[model samples]
Target: MALRFQNIKKKFGDLTVIRDISLDVGDDDFLVLLGPSGCGKSTLLRMIAGLEEVTSGEIHLNGRQVEHLPPSDRNMAFVFQSYALYPHMTVRRNITFPLIMREHKWWFHIPLVGYLAKRRIETKPDIRELVSITAETLGLTQVLDKHPRTLSGGQRQRVALGRAMVRQPAAFLMDEPLSNLDAKLRTAMRAEITRLHHRLGGTFVYVTHDQVEAMTMGTKIALLRGGDIQQFGTPREIYERPANTYVARFIGTPPMNLIEAQFQGDSLRIGDRLLPLPETAPRGDDRKVWLGIRPDAISLTTADAADALPVRVTLVEHAGAESLLAFDPGSLRVARDEDGQSDIMATQSGYSGIVAGDRVGLTLDIAQASYFDIDSGLRID
Candidate 1:
């Protein structure tokens, strides 16, 4: 049940939304299409499900080309963000709908006859047992007789999943399916879906703009920008060794700090402070580079600590298990923040006694730092 996209492209009139993209999703792999809005993650997912047409190139399922197939012929079940269950039908009816449609006949198209045929199909021994197993699997048996409107958001989402499960498709294509729930519910559902994937052991291609979801759930992530993939790798690979500045800034909480620096003979210069470079750092004299340091890699210490850079704390935020401190490294310019301000950030576990307006010493774990070419923004490995 692997999926392969070779030089795939999609366009709406003159505007191209998916460029010449090529990637492979292994059998039973949970591949997440991750990016910000308008990055074509959803469009790519739709292309896999045949809901949207590929403008060029090819899409293959298990080595068979399927880009030309219609939605029903693809054998992929789609779970949508809206939890698209029928309001007039009970949970059992909704879950059984796909099964009924698959065995439909010409006489089933008639108004009165269609209703009767569907009812008969729903009560068949095999259909009832299948629906019952799906309901119990999703913890939906208690709500089987209820309509969609009477169910909670989580329950309705389960019903949508149950509907998809009844088909036993080759792959599950989800498009932001958990986005409609509240924060707590979304967190619960994230775990639920992970467990479901493990139980079913089926291929899953999910699209989402949330980095947390991408990091926590995906076995592999394809990070896209505009219409092109910026980076594709496992969560640890992408986090520890980003391909470029865009990925460095997009993957972390508070993101990685990119500071403009000079690479001297044997040291890197940040503002007036000179620090020895890591053993693996690229050697260059008088070259400009972007120095990337994760927030967790910087430690706050007393002003007299060895190799510490003096900074003035500007803001301190207490976030449950950790404290985020934003500071000003005098005469040093930090890369532009998301809100257009320049500030160096650090994190300390548990509660922090340090407050704003305090001058402190910050020490960076030089070995953990990343270097990038200033002009190209690509990692300088």
Candidate 2:
């Protein structure tokens, strides 16, 4: 089902948390709401689930207005960060609870009368079959009788997911569902969730503060900051061509380096060095500009070559298959280090022989660089 948010706004009296946010999530799209803390991504998700009220605007589910409907009436399953499973109930009971509530009348919920409810439920073959299939799909069949506390973190999360899956809702809303897992488990769950999305073919609206989760799992990402969306696009589009300096700084591991420079004719003046701009590079009348270069795009070498800018290596970070070299370019204010010194980064494959205090030459790929307006901080190219 297609999910649409039209000019959605949320306010907490004097504070406007979500400001005119609008997005269209296509059917079966894994739309990720990514942002830092206090960015209103969770609040937006809650509003869609009817857990939080929308101050203004509309929410449409499959072309039907649902902003005014209760969460139960919306036919959407919510998977929470806390899992929110019932500790007293077994995994089977927890997974089938939603189904029972929906199918059985209120009188069946009474303590003594619930015995008849159990018999009625066992008589219905579909509910039992669904619970068994969901348990097997989530690898929780062995733990179907186990309490949540007895299961591992990953197993508990699976039970939580199983609960949502049995509901067979039109869409799934997840709020940092894997935040409790360790790094390795998080990686495993990421793949599992992606596979589940494919198998179910259900629309998933996920919220997370982790860029790795957003980049790897999302078909489209809505990058939010201070309750406003900085940019909304595919992972590659936003990473390669960021809408503004904020996005350029936020999306990557080492982040893109932003060098303050002056545009002079066909060249950019960074201190005393003149870096020539490619013919295809964006041009603006403004003399001042922000030049963005990803770490992987800059090549560092010991030998000096034409068009190479000499730099003093400040630090070399070794991370498994890649190494990040932080350097001080002649006079360009690219990024700041702990010592308040300006630094730029170049990434190399595998381990590096380069060390701190080593002098190296950096060759920038002008064609791969991005230009932004200094004043507005908006991308120029």
Which 10 residues in a row give candidate 2 its minimum summed lDDT? Answer: 108-117
**Residue-pair clash count for candidate 2:** 0
The regions of model 1 sitting more than 4 angstroms off are 105-123
Candidate 1: tens digits of C-alpha lDDT, residues 1-381: 388999999999999999999998898889999999999999999999998989999999988899999988888999999987778778888898888777763344535444853576556989888889999999999998898999999999999999999999989999999999999999999998898899897789999999999999999999999999999999999999999999999999989999898989899888777999878878789998999999999998987677788889999999989999999867786788668967998999998999899999989898999888898999988
The candidate scoring highest on TM-score is 1
Whole-model lDDT, model 2 = 0.87
In candidate 2, which residue ranges exceed 4 Å CA deviation? 105-117, 335-342
RMSD of each: 1.8, 2.2
